[model samples]
Target: MRNRINEEITLRKLEVLLAYMETGNLAKAAEALDVSTVSVHRALHSLEEGMRCALFRHEGRNLLPTEAAHVLADVATDVIKAMADGIRATRQAAGYSADHMKIGSLYSLTIRTVPDVVIGIKVRRPELQAELVLGSNADLLFKLKQGAIDAALMAMPEPDPEIESIALFEDEIYFAAPADSPYARQASIDLRQCRDEPFVTLSEGFITYQGFMDAFRIADFTPNVVMKVGDIFSLMNLVSGGVGYALLPGRVRDVFAHKVTLVPLSSQYRLRQTIGLSFLRRRERDPNLLALAAVCRLAMRVPS
Candidate 1:
C-alpha cells in the first residue's frame, strides 16, 4: 500500500514529466529542461518508484506513455496552468512600485469631493501618483471585490465583515429643480408636496436611491418617478431641463451651482448619506493601502 502511493511530487519533477511526454525521448527532454540526460533519467526513475507504476514503456530506445502516464499528463497541465494564473494575479495586486495610488469612487463624488480630496493627497504626498476610477457605486464595489481597485469612496450601509470603512463626511439630501421653476423658490417643501409631481431619481442599487425611497416611506408617500437615471448628474440634468424634480446630495450644489436650485426638505424626514473610504479589511495593513487611508482620513477633516 505504501509503495502504491507517490511521495510528495515536486514541481520540478512535474516539469520533467511534461517535457518528456512532449518530446517523447529522454535526451530531448533533458535538452528542453536544460539538464543532463542522466538527471532526466534519474528524475523519471524516482517518479516511477514513488508511484509504483511504469510511467513510460521502453520501445526500441524510445519513450512511450503507459495509460496511467496519459491520465497524469492531463492533470499536470491543468495544475501548471492554475499555478501560472495565481502568479499573474499576485503581480497585478501588487500594482506599481512607485509612490502612486489608485482609487475608485461613485459618480456623485467624481465632480467635487473626489477632486478636492485628491488635491489634498497630492499636496501632502507630492511624490505619490494618484489614479482615479469613476463609476456607479455598484460598479465601483464590484471592482473592489475583484481586487482591481485598492480602495473606494462610498456610502456605508450594514457591516460587511470582509470590508473596513471609515466615515469621511456626511451630506444631506435636498429637493432640486430648475432655478426658474416654482419648486426652487420655496424656502422649504413638504415631502408630500412633490409626492404627485413627476420625479427623476437615481437608479436602483445606489445608496441615494434607497435613501430617497426611505424618506418617502417615512412621510407615508411614494414618489411618482417619471424617469430613473444611473448617476446624480443625469438625474440633475433631467431636473435642470424642467423634466422633473429630484432628491440629490448637498454636494450637487457645488457642481451644478447656478444650473439648479435646492430647497431644504422638511427636517422631520430629512435624509443624510454618510460617505466613507472603504477597502478589504484583510489588506488594511498593507503599506500602500494604509498610506491611502491616512490621506483619506486627513481629507475628511473639516477646514477650520
Candidate 2:
C-alpha cells in the first residue's frame, strides 16, 4: 500500500512519455527532448514500473507503444494544456507581464476621453491590447471592485479609502433641449420654471441621472420623467427628437452640437460632474494602471 501511494504520476514523466509517443523511437525522442536516449528509456521504464502496467512492448531494437499508452497520452495532453492555461491565468491575476488590459468607462466618454486614453496607451505600449467595457457609473464601479476591469474612467464618486482616484476634469450639468425649443434661446435655464415639463433621462445608475435628480431636488420637485434610457447617446437622440427635456453633462455638446442645444443651468440648480480615473488601491503599482494614469494626467493638462 505504501509503495502504491509513493508511485504517483508527475508532469515531467508525462512530458517524457508524450515526447516518446510523438517521435516513436528512443533516438528521435532523445533528440526532441535534448537528452540522452538512455535518459528517455529510463523515464519510460520508470513510468511503466510506477504504473505497474505494460505501456510498451519490445520489438527487436525498437519499442512499440501499447493501446494503454495511447489512452494515457491523450489524457496527459489535456492535463498539460490545462496546467499551462492555469499558469497564464494566475499570472494575469497577479498583474504580471500582461499584454491585455480591460478598461471600463461611461458610454458618454467613448466620444473623446476613452479614445484619447486608449491612443496614448497604445503609443506607449504598442504590444498591449485594450478592451473597452462601457456601462453606467454604478455598473463600472461594481466591475472594478470585482476585478472584472483593470480601471474605470467615470464621474468621481465620494472618497473611498480602498480606491485610488485621480481627477481628470470638471463637466457642468446643462439643460438639454431640441434646437428649436424655446428653452434653447435662454442664456441660462431655470430648473424651477421647467418643473412641469416632460423629461427623458438616463437610467438610475448613470451619473447624469443622479445629477438630474440632485438638481431637481434642489429646486424642490421631482421631474416628470417620460422615459429612461441606458446610454447618453440615446438620451441625446430622444432630446433631439423632442421626446422630452434632459439634463446632460457639458462634455456631450460637441458630438450632438447640430442635434441638441445645451443651456447652462441657473445658479440654483448648478451641478458639475468631476470625471476621474479609479482603480483598486492595491493595484496602483500595476504597469497597465500606471500607464493609464499617466495618460489621464496628460489629458488633464491639455484641458479635456
RMSD vs true structure, all candidates: 9.8, 6.0
Instruction: Tell me the tens digit of each residue's lDDT in model 2 across 1-304.
Output: 4444335477878899999999898889999989999989889988888778999999898889999899989998999999988988987987654889999999988888888999999999898899999999999999988889889999887788878999999899999999999999999998989988999999989999999999999999988999999999999999999999999998889878987999999998899999999998988988888988998888767545
- Give the worst 10-residue stretch by lDDT in candidate 1: 91-100
What is candidate 1's lDDT per residue for 105-172, written digit by digit as tens?
88888766687778877776777788998766677777877778888898874688878888888989
Q: Each candidate's lDDT (Cα)?
A: 0.80, 0.90
Model 2 gets an lDDT of 0.90
- lDDT, model 1: 0.80
Which residue runs of candidate 1 sit more than 4 Å off their true CA positions?
1-100, 123-128
Error of 2 at 2 (Å): 13
Clashes of 1: 1
Q: How close is candidate 2 to the true structure, as a TM-score?
A: 0.72
